[model samples]
Target: MGLDWAYFRRPYEELHDRHDAAERQEYLVGRQPTAAAHLAELAPLRKREPIPASGYTGDDERLWQIMKLYALSRVSDYLIELFCPAGDPPPGFGVTGGRAVMEGSTTHRLELGGWQINATPGWIGSRRLELDELAAYTGFFTDIGLTPFEHAETFSPFHHEIFAVMQDPSATRVILEEVLWPGFWFGDLLFSRAGVRVRAPRHLIDAAVATTSTLYFTFSREPRPTSDLSHNWGSNSQWRTSFHRFYSDEDGLHLNWDGQVDIGEDPPQQPADQSDDPNPLDQRRELLLHRCFVRSALPRDEDDRFPYDDRLSLTTAEWPLRPESIVRVPWTR
Candidate 1:
């Protein structure tokens, strides 16, 4: 089934309006900070004013405001990651693998053994045969603050947790000041290895999501004790290195960033067998992490770092946004 674009259109507008009004009220209440103001500036789609969703009209500027917010919300993950503290790979990850075998067979079938068995024409005997097998493998590591969920950028699985913590306005501000700016700056440094930098208004970028909209993904099963894939071990180590280059978020392993990243030369893709296929992994998570960053950052290098967001925002675009469907089946000789 396809998205009910017509139905979706209305809700999208409504959510955008509500979010904008709330933020505006906060701004007027002297609750707004420079970071928020910076974020708010980028709400509208650059060249076009919001066209009313079909069947709505009049003085509902709120609709326009919200529509803009909805658009921005789409990239919230990137903005949040950019702003939140990251770096220092998360604990407990790397090289877990295993295999499982089926113990039962539901049906019995007789196969003719070459010419000898055919001539005999008798059951080899109702014996169990081994065939079906599944291989299980897992790798673990903290991805820092990378969104485990990837659907809408502004949406997060931890939104409730963060909001609960931000019940106090002061706390929210701290997040903006300490977490947001530095986190964002560091994210730029990490990805810029491939010469990509995305700098945009954070609020405007955040407003683009529907509140009901959320990122959903199935996490891989926890790593098991089996064979080891150590090279693939280490969680977001490269990302951690980038973060440390800027600032240390806490102590020990964590890191943060204080400013914009310098984009240098493009880095070659790591060997596929070395690290998981970033594209496929990005897809299973709906590319929420990758996409939000791309949308928020301005790509300055020849390589724009694969636009993972394009993979996540599948609802509006053409069908088959889910990458796993593209997995190939081996041909039999």
Candidate 2:
């Protein structure tokens, strides 16, 4: 037997009507406003019974796990959209789908949505070259409609800081202490991602900066499940099914970087087989997801009528200017 599961991102009012009309009517009569309020009212519905049963089949359990994981990932993406300044980014800017190819140590070619962004690493021990390349990449992103700031002036401080830090020999430590550490702390408080809480930011930063590399950030929407088996398994499977074609309103963001470190100059390494495992490196991307999600979820005091303020500024005050703060921070060596 195939396991089936469904999930919906519907309003609490809709869900309540389908599952328990009486209770929904009572809440509606009270004149409660806001989806959050309705959701709180319907919280009890979830505990009434397991969709299938308290004791689930093996297949049911497997599907449940997949759904839960997917849900958390969706939540993560939602938070990113909420906090990241680049609201509802274009098909490029790491959204949709893209590929990054390293043409040389300092140059990379990014292709997405029939557009291309050629990025030359900006901070590879050459101040002039780095600044020029940063300007070039900024223009490239702006042309593609992924402008990093609401106001062009906001870019000045960021550019200065990046250049200043890169020139200093203690750049790695400064970035960890001032940027990554604080950003991660702020993120942990918002997203409730326990995994990020236990790790040391110093170690993570050290690893990333240890090598001369080019980083590529990519975001893509998770494909919706199409199998019939995934659609028909539970008593309340209809409630679990996601009618929407996409996992999130936005794409799933992924961070990838490539570089080479001097084996002799750095600490001893594990054997080739052990070193080939991608989990440790992949965790870096997960850490970034947590950071962006929490930042995007940060509350803003703005006009209720205009919920989305594209002019909303994401500066050092609003969001810590960390390496992982933006949707994409491609550093070249």
Candidate 3:
């Protein structure tokens, strides 16, 4: 079922009422607003029930799984609209029946409504190309957690796991460019799905970076090192010494470049297997549905967000990045 817009509309009104009141106070008199307010504004409309595990004869759980995924995708899109810079993306940014249709399918630019990079006034061809390239990664999966199956036959499970990690902003962007985008590009052989173009308001990115740095460095780090965990401690030690460590760490992640590693190697091509290989576009659909899967699994407890299955780490081929591209990071990052 689609969003219960009527049911969800009142909270928006309440938020606006509060916002207007706050504005009249010169944004000063009341308790400082927080993301909690934003979360509460968005929380009421989501589906909270489960599909019957045993409903009909031969009813596989996949249908319920698909429904859950659909819900997550819808919610993620809604959240992005709410939290991400652009407000209320146009209907065009979404797919028909509120579904993610195909692997390489492009969404209507809802937030940017007819304000495409190519169409934006004063945008040069290079800028347009960059946006297109960036969108190849971000627009398709912005704040969404689904993974495509066709591109990487191995992706079905891994994508679900990554979607879980995306709940954390720092981890979200990091995983998108690292684990997800590269997989989409080399696995699906799609050229544009290789990088992220963040058009985020500078302040939000800055705030996120600030929040993340403190969390990762001071809070998440271990207080002392043990011999068994020496590697982790060493890494944390390296991380602690960096300038504005969080920004540097996140910048490296956003760019997907560590510079410690060498670049210039070609992605190894997957050998065609007739039995397992499906149509390339179908693979893209698999990928999109995987994203839908993640979207449907939202509002999970923080611990549930990163379901790292051991099966996923079995192969390095599941991750891919062009050697040359690795050396050249996105200018925006």
Model 3 C-alpha lDDT per residue in residues 247-273, reported as the tens digit of each score: 112223211111121112122122243
Return the top candidate by TM-score. Answer: 2
- What tens-digit string does per-residue lDDT give for candidate 1 at 1-333? 221212223322343353333442332234224223433443331222212323224344433443333322323322232222222212322101111122344454422111111121111111111111100000000121211211223322111111101112222121211111111222211211111111123322221110101222111111111111111335432111111121111111111111111011022234334443333342223223222211112222212233211211112221112333222111111
Q: Which ranges of candidate 3 are over 4 A from the true structure?
A: 1-58, 87-314, 317-333
TM-score of 2: 0.25
Each prediction's TM-score versus the true structure: 0.17, 0.25, 0.20
Give Cα-based local distance difference scores for all models: 0.21, 0.24, 0.23
For residue 296, model 2's alpha carbon misses the true position, in angstroms, by 28
Q: In what order do the candidates fall by TM-score, top score first? A: 2, 3, 1
- Model 1 residue 193 lDDT score: 13
Candidate 1, residue 235: CA error in Å? 36
Q: Which ranges of candidate 1 are over 4 A from the true structure?
A: 1-67, 70-79, 93-333
Q: Please give, for residues 110-131, the per-residue lDDT of candidate 2 as tens digits.
A: 4322355565422222111122
Residue 13 CA displacement from its true place in model 2, Å: 16
- Cα miss at 200, model 1 (Å)? 33
What ranking of all candidate models by lDDT puts the best one first?
2, 3, 1
> For candidate 3, what is the lDDT?
0.23
Q: Which candidate do you rate higher for lDDT, 2 or 3?
A: 2
